[model samples]
Target: MTKKVAILGAGSWGTALAMVLEENGHDVRIWSHKAKQADEINFKHTNKFYLPAVVLADSIKATHHIEEAIKDVDVIVFVVPTKAIREVAKKVVPFLTKPMVIVHASKGLEQESHKRISEILEEEIPESKRQAVVALSGPSHAEEVALKDLTTITAASTNEDASKVVQELFMNDYFRIYTNDDIIGVELGAALKNIIAVGAGALQGLGYGDNAKAALMTRGLAEISRLGVAFGADSITFLGLSGVGDLIVTCTSTHSRNWRAGHMLGKGNSLKEVLESMGMVVEGIATTKAAYELAQEKGIEMPITAAIYEVLYNGAKVEDIIVSLMQREGKSEA
Candidate 1:
């Protein structure tokens, strides 16, 4: 059955997903904060700023007004930046009059609060207004996914029926979807991998070899798994699509905003300078802070997260952080 899906962000990831839904014969409307972007998507059938090479389908419409986009929509996908999720969700609740599945492609935790995307959705939008909250995440990059590259992702929710609905909606020959009930693990793996991706970029910027990158990614997964387990996520979840799969792709890919941002930082640019150059939301910058705070509050030791946080926030040199990490007391790798 065809559904009316409202993707509440017109960024690259959002636009790419709009194409997926459009291909599936769903009525897709993308909401952009900037009216000019919406106009480009509607009239020009292109979003050059985000998906420069891909031609968006005319079946996918665009709207600047949230109410118009959400009106009678069966599914609302929040693909906005983590900072904007609350603001966007607030606007969505007022227009919501029916039971619509809430899905978000954002991969970052709210700063300081350290609340995952699903938790923020539950807090911002009352339970009565939404039918189910689903987190759609994995290793898929917007640029590649837009190119119709073979991609697989997981739709995770506490609600099995809701997750299956999303899985069925987006599945196709090139793009595949799986369902998982471990929302916490899937969300954490999605968010935390960016932090490690930044580290991977930093290593590249510092001209480190593959051995160093491999070590960083392996230990990065360990720290992520530790914190994830502390927060009630299944330890096994880290080994799945949202965890190891995501880490490998995000850490090595040039298309990753977090990796790009970190590569710049490692190449000796300030965080401010790096961010100014990217023109995109490098989620790891914010996620680093949230993960650092969460680790402290929960008494979980996340060395890599700490190193990234210090490099971004405290002006600590990556070299120094690496040396310190190397000198730390050794323990068995679990």
Candidate 2:
């Protein structure tokens, strides 16, 4: 069954998802905050700034108006940055006149509350304005997804029906969807992996070999799983697509904004300079702060996260942080 979908972001990830829904024969409308980007997507059938090489389907409509985008839509996908999730959700609330499945594709927690994207949506969009909240995430990269690469992701929700609805909405020959009930694990894995990805990039920038990268990734998963289990997520969920899968891709690939930002930082650029050069949100920068504080608050030992946090926030040299991490008191690997 075809549905009207409103995606409230026009960046590369949002536009790439629009392509997936369009191919599935759904009526897709993308909302962009910038009028010029909206015009580019609509009139030119391309979003040069985000997806430079991919030509968006002419059937996919683009608009700068929020109300027009969500008007009578069956599904509302929030594809904005984590920092912008609350603001955008507030903007859409006044227009959510009917029950629609709320799905968010953005990854990362709210810096202040450390709440997942679905939590922010649930708080901002009242139960009357939506049916259920779902998080769609995994190792899939926007650039590769736009190229029609074989990709698989998870649609996680406390509501099984809503997850299945999203699963059916986006699944295609090249793009596959799996339903998971572990919303907490799925969301946390999706968000926390960015922190490790930054570390992986820093390793690359600092001239570290594959052995170092491998150790970082393995130990990083241990930290993520420890913190995740403490926060009520299923420990086994860390083994799934949203966990190990996401960590591998985001940490190893240049496609990750967090990894790219970390690379620049490891290469001796200031955080300010890295952010200015990326022209993108680079979620791990903010996520590192939130995760570090959360770990400390909960008494979870996340050495990798602490190292990256110190490098990004406290002006600690990466080399010194690495040495400090390596020289920590030895303990048995669980």
Candidate 3:
């Protein structure tokens, strides 16, 4: 059945998902904060800055007014950054007269509260107006997905029917969806893996080969699973698509802004420079702060996360971090 869907945020990922929804034959409206961007998307059917050289479907419209975009939609997809969720939700609530199923593609913990994206949505959006919230995440990249690349992702929720709803909405010939009840594990896996991706980019920037990156990625998964398990997530979720799968793609792919930012950092560029150069939100940078703080609060030993935190926040040198990681006291490989 075709449903009216509102995708909040017109970034690359948002636009890409809009394409998927349009291809699936839904009435899709995308909300952009910038009126100019919305006008461009509607008039030209292209979001050049975000998704260059790709023509958007005419069925997918863009709106500057959040209330207008969401007023009559049956489903709402939040694709904005973690930091913008609260602000966007405030505007969204007033326009929601009926209960709407909520789906989030943002993969990051809130830097200030360390809350997952789903938690932030539930906190900001009133239960009376919102239906079930599903976490849609995995290793798929916006660029690849926009190209109709064969990609698989998961929609996780405590509510089985809700997740299945999302799965059906997004699944197609090129895109596949899986369902899981491990929302905590899925969200954490998606968020925390970015930190490791940055570390992987750093390895590449330093001219380290696959062996070193493989070691970082392997141990990085261990660190992510440790934190996820501490937060009451299923341990096995880490080995699945959202966990290890996301880590590998983000770490190695040129399409990952987090990896590119980390590469710049490893090559001695300032964080400010890297961020400004990319002009996109690098979710891993903020996630590193949140995960680092969470590890400290939980008394978990996450050496890799800590090292990335130091480099990002304390201006710690990349070379020193690499040396320190290599020189850690010998311990069991498990």
- Off-target runs (Cα >4 Å) in candidate 1 are none
TM-score per prediction, in order, is: 0.99, 0.99, 0.99
The clash numbers for all candidates, in the given order, read: 0, 0, 0
List model 1 lDDT by residue over 1-334, tens digit each. Answer: 9999999999999999999999999999999989999999999999998888999887889999999999988999999999999989998888889777999999999986888999999998988888899999998999988999999999999999999999989999999999999999999999999999999999999999899999999999999999999989999999999999999999999999989998998899999999889998899999999999998888998999998899999999999998999899989886
Tell me the lDDT of model 1 at 226: 96
State the displacement of the C-alpha of residue 306, model 1, in Å, after optimal TM-score superposition: 0.9
lDDT of 3 by residue, 1-334 (tens): 9999999999999999999999999999999999999999999999999999699987789999988999788999999998999889888988889987899999999977899999988988989987799999999999999999999999999989999999999999999999999999999999999999999888888889999989999999999999999999999999999999898899999999989998998888999999899888999999999999999999999999999999999999999999998999999988
Off by over 4 Å in 3: none
Q: Model 2 over residues 1-334: C-alpha lDDT tens digits?
A: 9999999999999999999999999999999999999999889999988889999889999999999999989999999999999999999999878878999999998987989898899999989988999999999999999999999999999999999999999999999999999999999999999999999999899999899999999999999999999999999999999999999999999999988988888899999999999998998999999999999999999999999999999999988999998999999999
Residue pairs in candidate 1 whose N, alpha carbon or C atoms collide under 3 angstroms? none
Error of 1 at 204 (Å): 0.6
